[model samples]
Target chain A: MFGGYNRRYKHFSPTLGCSMNFHIYFPPSPPSSPSPKFPVLYWLSGLTCTDENFIVKSGAQRAASKEGIALIAPDTSPRGLNVEGEAESWDFGVGAGFYLNATQEKWKNWRMYDYIVKELPNLLAENFPQLDTARHLYLSVSAFAPIGNPVNCPWGQKAFTNYLGGNKADWEEYDATCLVAKFHDVSATILIDQGEDDKFLHNQLLPDKFSEACKKHGVPVLVRLQPGYDHSFFFIATFIDDHILHHAQALNL
Target chain B: MFGGYNRRYKHFSPTLGCSMNFHIYFPPSPPSSPSPKFPVLYWLSGLTCTDENFIVKSGAQRAASKEGIALIAPDTSPRGLNVEGEAESWDFGVGAGFYLNATQEKWKNWRMYDYIVKELPNLLAENFPQLDTARHLYLSVSAFAPIGNPVNCPWGQKAFTNYLGGNKADWEEYDATCLVAKFHDVSATILIDQGEDDKFLHNQLLPDKFSEACKKHGVPVLVRLQPGYDHSFFFIATFIDDHILHHAQALNL
Candidate 1:
């Protein structure tokens, strides 16, 4: 939207040993600049979402265009792997990668952590020269309805058990609440907008626990509990402008 | 989106002889006014669209909320009619109503013109006291990728043949280009934004014919050919703010 191009790309991910699809919203280049390089904002969508959900539903491109930030949305999980029981549940295998590298042998294809952190950036730098991925202002915004404390929730517990075997230590490696304690040197403040009426707020998305963990680590985090909102993309579209402006302010735009 | 509530309502229409579902985006009421009534904007979606498409994909609520205009979206056609070949083609039957009344016996259920122009207004007035449908300022913004001269296009020719029989005279009543010559006393200027790169621009969406007809009838019409755009919700989302603003100005918001 807003004079931006939502370009799709498919690249081989060695981290997951499969082809992955990703979408990037490249804001219209400035008239003055011959080849404009934009700071990137990586949007990690929630469960049951592909790369297209953020591009189509978020309505963030309007602000992203004004702020001169490119948006990158990688697919939630590896597809066409043909792993047993992979396509069974909507919240488990296919669209629910949880952005973690799986430790178990059966679910080795779920290496979204490495895919997002390493391969995707390298791919953007190599292929899309107009994207400024090397800048420190490049920010990543995870889901508002995320599995914040994944080690405690049923959706996370089931996914962790299947993807990382029965090791609790392996599960903590992927949990945001657990990781916040270990790595507390975040540059920008974390902004999370949670819908008050989200059905998964109590069980699946434990943002309260994540907020508590962030407080314990002195990590500046702002968790907004929006009233009368749900976990749907409508909620995202409602607050996406504020999120984009927040990122723009952090990036000193 | 944006603070507005997208509420769905189902009411039995006497015109179509079926229960039809429609959505209304009620802009959050002004703080000073306890019970508010706002001017309405009727958004008629293109082919293969339901009431939900404009609510979900158009991102119009953001502009509607800002402009204090409530949006009403009706379904494209009378669904679940179970006609002999109603469910066969995507372009002809199910989702392609063309917003016209049918004269043929087999397609007698297709009375979208009366449903939109007559029944829906009565339903809104009876049920929704918060909507200002009685006002002359209420505006209707039809599709940007509409079958403007439907009598000449393949999609419209097939649908008209099926819905209204083989009479060429019946098709002229439904075609916008043909109807524009007859109804030239429009209060506000007609604004149509057509995508230059739209695949169906040359064949289906003949805005040129409509513009010519409006000119011949001395109707104030502005047809903008947006470059590098296509016939998708993305194109609509880009220009929806402008449309909303135009309606708001006409309503004296």
Candidate 2:
């Protein structure tokens, strides 16, 4: 039998001037359907996590297989020893890309937004025939589903802050709320699941802000605030079956 | 702004004399109902996977939040490296527990069934207050809904193999079908969704076999085979909202 899991590495040059890695999960497809196109779920991990965090931890393959959705998990930050303090602390160093291009010196080379929205999707559409880039859904937005059980942790806060930088003014571009508006033009619906107790992004900051933005754009946003849960894969896995269904309804599959 | 995530670790001693690791996802409870009990979902990962896989990748939390369900993901095999081939190839090593206890020497100490059924649930109920152990859904049974376009992939194979493992003569103890009848005294309604193009598990094996088994026990099984898709999370994420509705209807939530 063929190996159920396969990995391919791509060399991506982020704005931060550091080469990064992105991993794609390709579920087995039939030979007859050589060029099968699958919906894409772009997953953004928290700080202190690389592309491998979701691949290794979230027991999502079964649901993915059941749903036939392709997963694109990208590195949180660009990495290279040349960058100063790249390996220093968990929040500011290599593992913490904050999904934004930093304007500050030493981290100025990083441009995660462009990388995620541009480079990564471009690469996946080109390399993987199974991925449907036109219908991509941001996992972060749909994370508000109560099944994942949200948490309040330091890693999430630092990552969100870093993505927004010190200036809240830049929050729009770096915030998923802002991104949702841009996605609305291309996609039909937006789904976001969050934990009420999540420590990092803070329940009110993300879903609330994003909901307002999505509302302004006239995009349908499904936001669920799971009560009492914390940050972990367990919280997410509990409702994977439902997540698949949500995407299906949006995609009309 | 609270974070939406939860993380916890549990130690389980199965019948096979080995200690196991399990990770669980507890959906948040309503603030007014701090001690509310919620339904539970037991997620089983494929080879080379641990509990963390589904937690991160499956995107189930959003759905779980909407339906108020808890998720449980457990390691594929026992840890600590005492087994002879624990460090061997990825298919049979530390990550590949095959969801079975090793009857063969050097592997005999691996008891995944006991860990999944008895020990893990016990531990989860004790540690996680949100989970409703008394009224939970046994996911190992058919209750799976295909999310998007289905692909012919290993997931179909794993699902079938898992289903068979649960029904096979000697493995009945590890089987969800048997356990449901033996302990719960309740017949379950199973829902499975598959894409016609899935490359790994032959779609026929599951729907056909499972349907047969359910018929034998006078249970209802719903199987849907989607077309034009490959294995990926997109399949499930697309239809997750509907699945949650199904669960809600089943549980009268």
Candidate 3:
């Protein structure tokens, strides 16, 4: 291969009981920038997404390869461990974790929140020596969807009600709108691109809530409402490189 | 969106007897060369591949968008049908049509050759008016795997044997190695990328056969054996742009 391998790995996740699949793309070290270590970006896809979806569809690898930034894309939710009717609904049980920790009994083990933030990074850092150990690694504003689940409906309500119980306050930790006010990563600029014509905007996503949350908290957030764009990877594939550049800048590239 | 769109369409195929899905990407027309009509390249994926595989994983859109070459990716085989034992094996049935016309009584109707070379182009012309009607509208050298059944084995043997009957002569038409000597397209150069370390090479694919055939026929061919790369989109994503440029040159872009 011209660059290093875009590898797929399946490892035991202590957080999520089931074996999770994560795709990692390590940029080929160019001669000019001969640093052995690369800054890693954690990509958390939206509802009805998998690890392969972003890396596969987004056209991000070309820029990631060029910028010398390694990309780590985790599966949206845990699989294998049958968490009650997980396969029944497209949005509720599996494939729509919403990257949240379940407070309820049955799915309390659906710990994608911990997996993405903690376990995966630790695993990556330990396994791939090419990543800079000292640098901070976590997903921040570089996502295509609106942060908070829009008013807890569609997959969001199904996930929250099932995972976090009827108490809506418990959803705040996972909700982007609520989390932004409390997020401590002050330097990481919030970068969101919402398609104005996105089909799911009515019930599934609302960018204004997250935007307003950022504004209210006096945090830097740039929400670009792209006209004629949609919720499909068509949107992500359209602007993935810009998001990568935003990440590259954060990495001091 | 940076480019026009990675559009999806579902249409009835008279050949496959099923609703076929084809993904077409119309590259954004540049202001420098404003033309409503754009040349296109048809991408036929390897075994166990779908219409989304190349466009989703290969990172071809950015270069295609820049080159002003639209890409049409069709599913590997006819789907949405209750073909006998179609889902039983990965290579034999659903995902592994081998892109050949089935001559056997059971699968004579599996006319991927007709669909790809004829019905698809006509459909494209009828649906997308911006396409240049006079130009070629089918796949040639820009496929993920080697063509021409490679001495008749792997899924190729099963497909050819089942689809084209037991006659080896019947397979020659779809076989690139055999057809190179007979193909009349002397003006179009052949571009093939074979990863040297591809796992399928041992069992299924043989690029040397195709390469040797091209040389003997005096046809212009570039067979790049990418070292250490395997039979995956990783290889395609790495060298997709160069492949597009090759197609653009042929399209006289």
Candidate 4:
């Protein structure tokens, strides 16, 4: 929207075994830089959200356009799988992939973790020549009302039981709170904005727990509790510029 | 979203003969202003839009918050009237009031002209004490793909036929292009931004016709033809900052 071209592309995903669509916002090439390619910022949306939510609502493109960064928004989950009772629940199947690789055979198509972490990057590097893959930054691991410590929440319990089976160890593998302690070699400071007025603040989202884990692991993190804000795109839109600027500085733009 | 309170209110409207809903974006009150009331910018949306479209999509709140301007977005047309076949067409019926008073007996409830022009302001001044009614400015009369000379366009013709009893004379009363020549005492320069790539640019919009009429009437106008843009909220979000700044200057903010 802000002097950027937002393009959508559909590609068959080998990981998810279903066709996926992603939206990319390419800012106008910087005339000052010798390199033609722009840095990347990938937005991972939360529950019940597709690739279009961030592209349409976040208002992050204004700052991304100003900083000469490209934004890639991947679909939250595989669609049209027609798995039995997949479309029934808002929290478990379909849009609620939780960005985790499924351990269960029935929910094997819910491999968003591999799709986002491995396949999507390879696809971007191979196909999108205008993107500078080296200078990439993943912002907002999960947008509004993020499951900070998913393994400790009911949402995680329900989705994990269905997708990952009864394995506690497997659930911890996908949990960022647990991963922060295991892989504490993270160089950059993780920035998080949690809305105090969010309905899921105490129940689904436990940002303080993640912050404590990060502190114990010696990983630098900033979790700002925004007052009078809710778990809506409105809250995201308000602070999107600051988040984009944070990424820009981390990318040394 | 942008450090502003977006509040939605519903009140009975005598003009429309139905309950009406309108959204208002109140910027944080300027500490410097002697009077607490803020200058307002009224946004009249086009077809298939309600009070929420601009509130959710345009991202104008950021600019309005910066400019210390309150934004008021009224419903496009009266709702829940239950007139036979009122909900039939997407363009002519429910969402498309054309901001004109209806002359036809069946569509007598569609008095958006009186509602917006006379009743809304009074309602705001009486109910919303925080708004300065005197320093008000109406921006984007018919947001995206505006029917400039509505009397000539097919959309306008159909809408006028049903709402105004197939009379061309009644159509001229609400047509901006037609009214410009009759009441050209506008002191400030009118600014318009039309997407060049909009599908309805030449057919339904007809911006040049409005510009020509404004020229003939000696009313100052600036029509910007935005390239590679289309009839979407993306196009609005791109140039909303410029439009807000223009209004701020005109209001001497």
Candidate 5:
């Protein structure tokens, strides 16, 4: 068993209020160790979660200790200060960051894309010597629940249209498919595991779209679709060993 | 992030008293998902640690969530009343189980080996369906301090001694010169990464003894001694990615 400390910092999010907090877990490091030399794994949690969700919930420390990997889990969305009508539903508002830089009127100030992909990684790399920014991987558990084609479900179109601001083009940047294509230069391999029965993300739309986008950009993606599974951590936890192994394999360590 | 409720159980130890806690992290299961199964990575923390040490220190949730693997971390040693005098120093006392069952008088009740290798695994398998026991792997970091000739460290000696304890009166187990012969029947591969400058385990002892043991048993051991490294998690974290990759390659995942 090992114990370490987490230093918290406040980052300004135009979309969320001024009280947003991000955490960085630094493995206990000896002072004499080299600086700016550790690799990092950036984790994107699902909707209705803060950065603390994964940190508190996922049982990943053993593997991290064994593999010596550092994890960075960011809040799903911005928080603080009530945006009118933000609390209406569980899908959106405070918890749903959607990994996008919102462009719509009310959410124009919200920019999860930059915060997640750029700011968070930058902050972690700048602060921790044990983190290797050059070699980082991105992970998310079913972030696209209400956006894509619902397939055989009715809620799909409604959620997609509402969250996307009634335009398919608006979904592009926030869409992992589009994000992967835009950031094709990313060195880390993309890993997406989704349950077949996820109510928000129709199995067909997510894995297929993400795969298509990855393939188009020469990104190597290992997509595992568990049949009859739903959106839950059990599915994620069941396969975490493989994910660590995947990153480990990619790093060849 | 995934969280599960873990219940506490007590086991009696003549030497360590009644202070052992076992907890299992269960990933959330989606309503529609089939029974999810995950591979288990059992973690053994270093000295002065409880079951919670690695769980809190290592930033492994992101990878674990991504890979869906179950991580099980156990306490370093037994605690509580009556086990007082288990050792005269920090290296031998309440915090240092050493993953070995004690044979000496005042410490005879310290059966850490049984607790770690037998009881812990059994409890996990019985309680968590996501964990696959067949794919279990054992890992130790700075497990033993320098005990043998500086030229022939204690890691190998401890491992060999433990192996012998499990198979007493077997000369075949004493043969440490044949790698393949040593690991012939053990299902799990042995992976040990020690820092050359580790204050605890001498560099030469672990590697040499491990190599000799594996050679005698016809088992191949992967021992990596990082140059100028010390007995800190930083050294382990530096090469954690490699360890994951090794497991991936071994599992052919």
Candidate 6:
């Protein structure tokens, strides 16, 4: 039994002008041996999530540790900001980052995409050198109950308008369907597990659009419509073992 | 693979005079046949914790499921009441029940002891007959980082003074050391895991007093001093497997 160990770190990001709270879990490894570099599975949470949400609630670490795969759960968006009306709403501004760089003028400094895609990985590699493996390291993003068409939905619309302004073309980069269709050189298979009984179904979270786009771009997609499951982490926890193996196989670990 | 399932229920408790939220997990029992009754491990959280604390953070469900044992985690204290200074301090009122019935005139109605020991079990049996076992069903209270002498510690001193009033006699009923000495009919072997490096050890929480009292009473007590561990749930998660197995063995499951 490789006993699991979790560390909570405060990372100062120049991109967001904030000290971010991120949790990194290292599987039980021997103390004497040089720590083996492991593949990472980045679990991006949906709305109203801190770095602790998935790390604490979802039992992902067991499968992760067993597979010798490291798991990193980051806060959905930048937090503890006193910017006007930030604390009032639950969805927008703080906890609802759509994982995109803001193109708008006012919220240009809210570079969550840069922090997530670039800076956070660099920080992880720097702080925990045992995780440093190769230059070709890239994350396979998997969200349990993710926002699909962020540019159109009310929650996403407000966040996009506030973060990326009125430019429709600029908004394409943030939307999953738009981004996937445009990008090439994709290798890893994308897996999407949507609950059939979810309240977010039919609208709000359009998983079909993302799947269709992936299909069109020759990017292998595995979309599993799980029956009688809702949008809670219970759904995620139920399928977490499969998800870990999915990533492990994708990374060829 | 007994796939685990967790259900969070808000039961209207007659004992606490409030709707209490408790988390119960049914280990992956088989789908067919009359569902087998599983031995329960009643896990009581430490100071300043809710029912969600251990269930969400401890990762005990995995082990309990593996052992075919059920787990019931009740809230640290009843919530949503405006009892003067109840909302003020973290240690005194809301999150701190000290796992005992209140005797003070003001807090006479605070029957947390009855809720945990009696009412909650009845509700579980009434609602889910699969949990109903022998008539003389007893709970094995295994605590990790628990308050040893509640009546003596500073945090417990404040709680006891308010809940049980100035009566030292009333305070003894709540204190573990005093309760163990007085009560001769201890059915289950008490299992306690104390972190050696806990900050609460130097003050606030003294494990030795309770252990000594249990030894004097000829009660079977297993006190494990886990080295290099803190008071956080991470510490509990590290040793949760052993704790689950400890309860499983005590119940003879």
Taking the tens digit of each residue's C-alpha lDDT, what string does model 6 give over B100-188? 89877677657788888789877887787767444455556567777888778898788888988888888888888888888857767
Candidate 5 to truth, TM: 0.46
Candidate 2 residue lDDT tens string, A150-181? 11234444544554456655544555555656
lDDT (C-alpha, whole model) for all candidates? 0.87, 0.59, 0.77, 0.86, 0.56, 0.77
Candidate ranking (DockQ, best to worst): 1, 4, 3, 6, 2, 5
Tell me the docking grade of candidate 4: medium
TM of each candidate vs. truth: 0.97, 0.53, 0.86, 0.95, 0.46, 0.85
Model 4 per-residue lDDT tens digits across residues A35-102: 57888888888888999988998888899999998999999899998999898988989899988899
> TM-score of the candidate numbered 4?
0.95
Report the interface RMSD that candidate 6 achieves against the true structure, in angstroms. 4.5
Better of 1 and 3 by lDDT: 1
**Among the candidates, what TM-score does chain A have in each?**
0.96, 0.75, 0.92, 0.95, 0.75, 0.92
- Candidate 4 vs 5: which has more lDDT: 4
In candidate 5 the C-alpha lDDT for residue A70 amounts to: 67
- Expressed as tens digits, the lDDT of each residue in A96-126 for candidate 5 is 6666666666765457777777777767667
Worst 10 residues of 5 chain B by lDDT: B142-151
Q: Candidate 6 — which residues are off by over 4 angstroms?
A: A1-5, A35-38, A79-89, A139-141, A149-162, A165-167, A182-185, B1-12, B26-29, B34-39, B66-69, B78-81, B133-135, B165-170, B182-189, B215-218
> DockQ of each model against the real complex?
0.76, 0.12, 0.47, 0.76, 0.03, 0.26
Off by over 4 Å in 3: A16-18, A31-35, A85-88, A138-140, A149-162, A165-170, A182-185, B14-19, B29-35, B78-89, B136-140, B152-157
Q: Residue B145 in candidate 1 has what lDDT?
A: 66
Q: Can you write out model 6's per-residue Cα lDDT over A113-210, one digit (the tens) per residue?
A: 89988898888777777774454655454555566777767777888888888877788788887878778457777677878779987678888877
Q: Give the Å shift of residue A51 in candidate 6.
A: 2.5
Candidate 2 chain A minimal-lDDT segment of 10 residues: A144-153
lDDT of 5 by residue, B1-91 (tens): 3333233355554334465775454444445655777666566676667776455434343344445555566777767645556545555
Candidate 5 clashes: the total is 47
User: What ranking of all candidate models by lDDT puts the best one first?
Assistant: 1, 4, 3, 6, 2, 5
How well does model 4 score by local distance difference test? 0.86
